[model samples]
Target: GEFGKVEEVKESLDLAYMIKETQNLFKGIVEGSSRSMQIVKDLRTFSRIDEIDGVIQFMCNPCGKLSE
Candidate 1:
């Protein structure tokens, strides 16, 4: 019964083409994920630098005071 089912499935479609298409789809997903991660990393680094700059500027300016 199992062998008959396997033979019937095997006759239905091209396995090679399916495997190739699956591989290409996975490759694109991996590349896109990698690119997205890189962009997030760069954004974090930029935000940190901007925060530091703001702190430095505030410290350097004597008029930057808070009255409470």
Candidate 2:
């Protein structure tokens, strides 16, 4: 039947569209996760630098007081 053939074609096209959309969604998720990981990495690096700076300041304070 011609009508049956038309319906089958429509179903196939819909399935293809869904597959494409799903792939795009997954790609976006991966990109977003990568960005989030990078942000966390940067935050950790900044925190470490802040800790080092604090230690340096603490070590210098006693010397400053002795000089005063």
Candidate 3:
């Protein structure tokens, strides 16, 4: 009976560790995807700079910073 109880405890601990690891992996994937999305958005804004009526636009905000 004592040995069975020890085995159960070990299994529970293993499951907890695996869950934590999975969470960390998903977090990284989400962060990477967000960065990629931002890059694409910035590229779109940059492309629009050349779309004016023969006038080059800075494509920036009032603070002189690139619009996010």
Candidate 4:
């Protein structure tokens, strides 16, 4: 009975959700800026360059299995 009372106590959780939400809000602010938009565009271009990265990795897996 006494131990069960401890289990019912409110537990404080870490601030990870607050940090994530604030980061998302800040990201929106940054992305909305003109300079950030240019950087975002550049990022998109760079990201697209790796659009085939997964394909290349997938190909390597089969090749490695075959070479075994």
Candidate 5:
């Protein structure tokens, strides 16, 4: 009876560990996706610098002339 109880506990512990690992995997996926979305947003923002008349370019490059 004691041996059977030990086996059950071991199985339960294994299941718990698997669940924790799955949760961690999902968390990493979400974080990676958020970072990717931010990169895309930043790219769009910089791409629109042409529409803003070189304001961003001036800020990034001090030597560049800023249009009045």
Candidate 6:
């Protein structure tokens, strides 16, 4: 059955293409998510640098001026 064989090949190729496309999409999403997470972390760290330093100094000071 030449037609049957041709149909089977076409189906196989289509299935493989779909799988490849899905895998690529997932990979892109994961990469983008990880990059976004890294950017958020960096921003948070940068924002907190001064606050963290001030907090540490407050902790070192027994006067507890942070109540103000």
Candidate whose TM-score is highest: 1
lDDT of each: 0.84, 0.85, 0.79, 0.70, 0.86, 0.84
> What does the lDDT come to for candidate 3?
0.79
Q: Which stretches of candidate 6 lie over 4 Å from their true place?
A: 1-13, 50-68
User: Mind sharing the TM-score for model 5?
Assistant: 0.56
- Residues 5-53, candidate 1: write the lDDT tens digits: 9988887867878999999999999999999999999999977886877
Lowest lDDT 10-mer window, candidate 2? 59-68
Task: Predict model 2's lDDT versus the native.
Answer: 0.85
Q: Can you give the lDDT of residue 67 in candidate 5?
A: 60
Across 1-68, the per-residue lDDT of candidate 3 in tens digits comes to 99999999989789888889999999999999999999999988867765654234443344566556
RMSD of each: 5.8, 8.2, 7.2, 12.2, 6.0, 6.8
Candidate 1: residue pairs that collide? none
Flag the better candidate by lDDT, 2 or 6.
Answer: 2
TM-score of 6: 0.55
| Residues 1-68 of candidate 4: C-alpha lDDT, one tens digit per residue | 87766655423333677789999999888767968789899988866666756654545575556444
TM-score for each candidate, following the candidate numbering: 0.63, 0.61, 0.54, 0.31, 0.56, 0.55
lDDT (10s digit) by residue, model 5, range 1-68:
99999999989789888889999999999999999999999999877975578666767667876566
Cα misplacement distance, residue 16 of candidate 2 (Å): 1.0
1-68: candidate 2 lDDT, tens digit per residue? 99999999989789888889999999999999999999999999977886877864556575656444
Comparing 3 and 5 by TM-score, which wins? 5
